[model samples]
Target: MRPTDIDDPQYFHRVVDCQWACPAHTPVPEYIRLIAQGRYDDAYMLNWESNVFPGILGRTCDRPCEPACRRSRLPEDKPVAICRLKRVAADYRGDISGRLPQIPAAKNGSKRIALLGAGPASLTVARDLAPLGYHCTLIEKDPRGGGLMRTNIPSFRLPEKVLNEEVDYILRMGLETRFGEEVTSLKAVLDEGFDAVFVGTGAPRGKDLDLPGRREADANIHIG
Candidate 1:
C-alpha cells in the first residue's frame, strides 16, 4: 500500500468520524481536549466558531455525531457525551464579550441587506454579514428573535436566559432589528430598496397523521 495522505481533507474526516458527521463539521476532538484541559472558555469559543448557538444546540441538538463516534464502534463502550460536554463548556465559560468579532463602525461599501424572520438562519446571516460591514436589517413578526426556537421549544428544554445571551451576541454587532413586524408580501419587501433580501421564515405548521382519532384527539395530540 502507498503512504497515507494525511494532508487530504478527506483523510481527516475519515479519521474523525464524529466531526465528519456533524453538520457544522466542528472540530470535536480539539474541543474535547480543551474541555479535558479545563479550558472551558476556549472550548466554548471553538464550538461557537463552528456552531453559532452552542448552548442551545447542546440542549436541543439531535446529536448526529454521537452515532458516528469511534467509541461507539467498540464493544461494550459508549460514545463520548459530546452534546453534554458542549453544555458544560457553555455553562462553565467566563464572560466572552471581549472575544467576539468586532463589527466595523463604518459600513463596508454601500450595500444593504434585509433579512426576514429573526430565526437562527437570519441571525446567522446577520452575524456573518455585519462584521464584514454590510448593514443588515432583521425583521421579525414576533416580539423577540428566535422564531420557532422561542415559540416552539419549552423553557425546560431550552432556558430563556441561555437563548437570549446567544442571540444578543449577534444583535450587538449593530444589525438593525424590526420586531413585531410581519412581512406579508415579498413584492412589498422587495420594494423597500434593500440591495439584497433573504427570507428565513421557518415552517410554522406541523404535518398531521390522517388517522381515525387524529382529529378527535387533536386537542391533546400534537405533531412535532
Candidate 2:
C-alpha cells in the first residue's frame, strides 16, 4: 500500500470529515476550540475568513458539516451543533469594523468591473475586488442590495438588521452602486466600455410541474 500521502492538503481534510464536507473547508476544529475558550471575536473572525457572512450563514446554512461529523459515528452520540455554535460566535463577538480589509484610495488598475445584481454572489465579488483596488459597479433593480435575500426570504427567518449589517460591510468598501435600474440590454452595457461584466441575477421563477391535472390545480398548486 502507498503509505498514505499525509502531506497532501486533501488528506488532512479527509481526516477531519466535517471540514472536508464543508464547501468552504473552514478550519472547523480551530473555530470550535476558540468558541470553547470563550474567544468569540477570534472565532467569528476565523469563520469570516472562509465564509464571508458568518452570521447570516450560521443562521441559514443547510449545514452539510453536521452529517459528516465524526461524533455521529459513535453510538447514541449526536453531531456537534456547528451551525448554532457559529451563531453564538456571531452573537457574542466584539466590534470588527477595523478588522475588515482596507480599500485603497486609488484603484489599482484601469480595469472597471460591472456586476449586475447586488445579490450575495455579486456582493462577494465586489468585496474581494474592491479591496484589491478594482473599480466595481453594482447595478440592481431594487432600491438596495441583498437581491432575492430581501425579496424572497422571510424577515423572520433572516432578520433584516442582520442582513443589512453584513451587506453594508461590503458596500462600504468604496464600490459604486446604481440601484432601482434594471438592465435591458447586454450589448448596451458592453457599449459602456466596462473591462468585464458579471451577471448574478438570481432566479425569480419556480419551475412548474408538467404532470396530469396541471391546468386544473394551477390556482392551488404553488411551484415553490
Query: Whole-model lDDT for model 1 versus the true structure?
Result: 0.92
Q: Estimate candidate 2's RMSD in Å.
A: 3.5
TM-score of each: 0.90, 0.89
lDDT (C-alpha, whole model) for all candidates: 0.92, 0.90
Error of 1 at 200 (Å): 0.7
* lDDT value, residue 49 of candidate 2: 78
Off by over 4 Å in 1: 1-9, 209-224
Candidate 1 per-residue lDDT over residues 1-224, each given as its tens digit: 99998656687586988988898888899999999999999999999998999999999999989999989889999999999999999999999999999989889886899999999999999988998999999999999999788988999999999999999999889989999998999999889899999999976677877988778897898777
Q: Tell me, by lDDT, which candidate is best.
A: 1
Q: Give residue 172's lDDT in candidate 1 (0 to 100).
A: 89
Candidate 1: clashing pairs of residues:
none
**lDDT at residue 67 of model 1 (Cα atoms):** 95
State residue 93's C-alpha deviation in candidate 2, in Å: 1.3
